[model samples]
Target: MLGGGGLVAANVYASATEGGWGGQSGPDATGQVKSAGMATIDCPDVGSRLTNVPDGARADVDRALAELDRQTASAYQQLQASAQALSADPHAADDSVMNPLKDKRSATIERIAVAIDRVGDRPEGLESLAACALLPGQEATGGVTGGTGQPTATASASPGGGQGQGGAGQAGAGQGGNGPVASDYADITAVQPNAPQPAQQADASRGSFTSDCGVNANGLRNSDNVIVAPGVSNGAHHFHDYVGNQSNNAFASDDDLAKADTSCVDKGDRSTYYWPVLRLQNGKQERDAGAPGGGTEGNAGQIVTPKQVTLTFVGNPRSKVTGMPRLLRIITGDAKAFVNGPANANASWSCTGYEDRQLKDKYPLCPSGSDVVRTFHFQSCWDGRNTDSANHRTHVAFEGPDGSCPEGFRAIPQLVQRIVYDVPAPSVEDGGRTVPLFAVDSFPEQLHKPVTDHGDFINVFDESLMRQMVDCINSGRTCGAGGDGGASASPSAGTGTGSGATAEPTAGASGTPAPSASNPSELPRTDATTTPAHTTKHSAPGEQDGRGEQGTDDTGRRTKQGGRSGHGAQATPAGAGTSHSAAPSASQAGEIGQAAQSPEPGSGRTTPPPAQSEPQAVHGGLAETGANLWPAGLGTLLALSGLVMLIRAKRLRY
Candidate 1:
């Protein structure tokens, strides 16, 4: 009980101080590369769209950015001076120093924060900036620092290797994201299929292709690591998810991904899918992995996994479907729906068992037995020969009720991706209000801005798998990852003749698979969006590994209790506790296992949702670590905490 008490205290304190910018310096090499990024500040393309903007608004934006630039430079200079002082005398805070560096850094961030607020008023301008890869745009190139104001990139994902590892990728560029099926979404005693009804997917003249990639937690959170289009410059500030190649990065080439291993069970399937990572805001936190400790402000625990991941490509209702080209990444749900008001709320939102109860509220909770979920269904109609459009989405359109491609659009495999998260029930049993959860990223700085959440994908499916998927759906066979998701590939499959040309080109003229994890393009409203976790260089105050006494890197990737994660470190988000501790509440224990396991797609019968549990013990940390922008500590702790916060803040900025 005493040992348990200590563990509980650590978690509570950690939870209280999970997020916020830390004031520490980032890794030297990574920092230098990100800082030296070649992007310049200027949105010339945005100026072209000025007519759509209000008169003189362009100047306002310029002024605001200039202010950001000016403040940033001053703060940086001051920060350097403070660092020099610290070098001469390590005293920080009361001991012998005031940590002028932290002060200046905070001031700079505050000024930038204000500038961001003013610019946020102009949504169109931001979008254009994102689309055009203007100032600080990342696109394929990593972003510029605006002169060292941006936070350093967090620790890189470690090389994949661990227990329960499984992932599907294009070919064999890299190993699958590590960690085997430690848990499933729910209890499997009563498991069954979760596919749409036959009529919902079938039309006499169309065909489809589909795969079931399990939940992903390793995709990079950086927006600059473009995984879709080829050789595009910094064109976006928004964040997205990526998959397939483990080493896939902003500079990854097509050949790199083609050699990557698959994360799914189907080795032949080489497609990559990604979506926005979600965060629970009702308060969850941990302290071991470099995250701060102690705060009354509820916790923002570990980054969460989507409950489910489903990928499908179908044809327009009236036309025969063609096999898709290799590197076609598309978006389905409207991230902007959560922001920019109701007009853009076209993306689907709902819980598992509460299907009838579609969610209009941002971050709605799931019913007692259901999971938090989001679904993205791409267009089925395509322009016969082209794989993309200038804007990225217009080339593909959905089929109407009649099952026909309206005009020039011919049928291609339509894609539908459904991602689910095993969110636990709220603490207040009596109340029915949904606690707010959010997804934070490097862009848009406005925490909890719903529009910032988005999903994307780059289909690198080998043509054989593509044709097989097409054959499976056209023939009315319900199949998945080489298994019977709803039904087996029909004995009489290949019933319908295919659309498009019979001969598939050798991916590109270079004779490689199309662009994928190594090559992805941004599609404005139409796209989807992977990363692994790594240990950090810094350790938090009173931090320990899962073994209790062993030290940890405090990077939030590995926990003291051995509950590790790459994205926010492996653990439940929002109201939950760490996965490292062996003794989770009865309900939490179940959640840990469920979240670790991949949800199986079956006919109406699927894994049964775990029974809801009452709120467990309400414990708090014994030793508190303050989360204030300006930390209060006895010299050393202050420097450490403040430094960590600065790192957290800037690294997470978009």
Candidate 2:
């Protein structure tokens, strides 16, 4: 079913017997409909279904789809704003929100059909999908209640309508009156270990390559989604944490990214890696507290800097890997999974000690000594033709259940991302009365659900580095650790074929340098330079960096990192700019909120500081700085169900 269309159909059938959309059966308690509550708009996901869009028409279609999303988002916000009117008269929902939204979508959908028809065949029945339904946020759709027996925050009132205030300096509830209730998390210790071992053949390429990009301590963030909604400012409703490329923004071109400076110790890697920022709902506001994609977009609270971010690339279990084409873009999870269904959901959540028990739908609740972990295993099988597809996904896919590529597809080195955080465990049983909750930023209608957590990547590895990565995996050589190229490890190191549980690719094995002082080897270092090649500006505690906070300048260019720009609104251009610019500050850059770039390096270019070793996670305390070994074949075929709880481990002081 499309966007829970079946639920809407059920409501339609029930209306005849129940009364109306808000009608109720004879009630023993109240005469009102027992199901009356907050609702969000749900419609068919047009972009996901368009697999055959012509290249000539792709741009037009993408813009149309993005407009459709914007329309839905605006309608949902209006729905929230009119909560009182809707509760007073259910017809208000149709008159003010749903009907108007349908008209807008119909016109947009027609444009899409026409664009495709000009180059290919016109799609029929798209008009039927224009209409949407206001499904109750707590009903038929997966639960949003936090186990407090209260309905989802969206069903309550307008934003800030009695939602709890943030902890300190922050403005409102960390959830921005949207979600992340008690029901979103589960205890990791109570979860049964269900991680299945990948069936590797004798010919499996068991080697792994790791790239140590820092934890984004520089605080680079944005709301632009270059892959899905390029050129549109605030394309992603929520904020995203960025590392790897310093020149990335909605308007950044492939050449711009290729020419950009990298945060990786190996300068050859200019790839861009980003994901929705995880925020501590404790209400400590960062600089974007009042900016678009921040507090204004329902993403509130202090953004938690990742304590450690591990980027690893491993080989296929069934075949030799090939070098990924440069500039290949991959999106690993579904940002709209909460409403789009679990069909393409790929989020993996767990604690360090309990990684064998991964969860997808719920956030994991870890015990006192562990830290929260989020992992993303990108789709590894490429069609061997297109680097990207119309849907931004059809060009790449996960291996079959048998761990083999589909016909015409070839296995490339799979990128496995592991991010760890030190957060106090929420008291879910008591509804976070003691500890504040944490959640990933999400589209407003998604209600900040855990299932919506996702990541994005764009491979910019130079030809030489990419070749080395491919060779390392295919030859089963554990290269890149200890700053060594083509380094060989014990044959059985990463094979997961030995006798003990340690044989199953734990964090301190193989060529992956352990967090030991005596052995200071790190992962994927082509050079041993300890100092960063360039300097980057970072905001002081409580200060804001306008250029990095998703705001654009007068011409709508997102400035590089530097001082916060004047209060510039997020740009919402229909098409991306053809060139990149570092405009002056908002005060000087005209009425539009274009921002100035961060101060450039001596070379007159923007580049990130070099990567440094991070604190590795120990069972009970913080270990010294070293590369943490992730499983060679992680997140492949991993199932998602429960959520995770963040526990405060010993802090890893810089």
How well does candidate 1 score on lDDT at residue 428?
A: 18
Clashes of each: 104, 20
Per-residue CA lDDT of model 1 for 1-654, tens digit only, reads 333444455555545454211111112333221211111112122222232323234334434333332333233223223433433433332232223323433443344334445645434333323311112212111212111112333322211111110111011000111100011012211222222222333455333344544344333333333433233322223334444444344555667767776554455555656555454332243221121111111112345544344454544444456677776656554433322334423344444433322333233333333445465556667666655443345556666656677588766666655555555433111111122123323122112233334556666777777777777656644454323433322112121101001111011111111122311211011110111011112334344423243232322222332222211112121111211121121122122112232212211111122222323222122332233322222333544566677777798994
- lDDT to native, each model: 0.34, 0.61
Tens-digit lDDT track of model 2 for 312-429: 7888887888899988999988998977998888878876555656778888765433457788888999998888887889999998877799889999988877776655456432
Consecutive 10-residue window with the lowest summed lDDT within model 2: 495-504
What TM-score goes with each of the models? Answer: 0.44, 0.67
lDDT at residue 371 of model 1 (Cα atoms): 49
Error of model 1, residue 34, in angstroms: 41
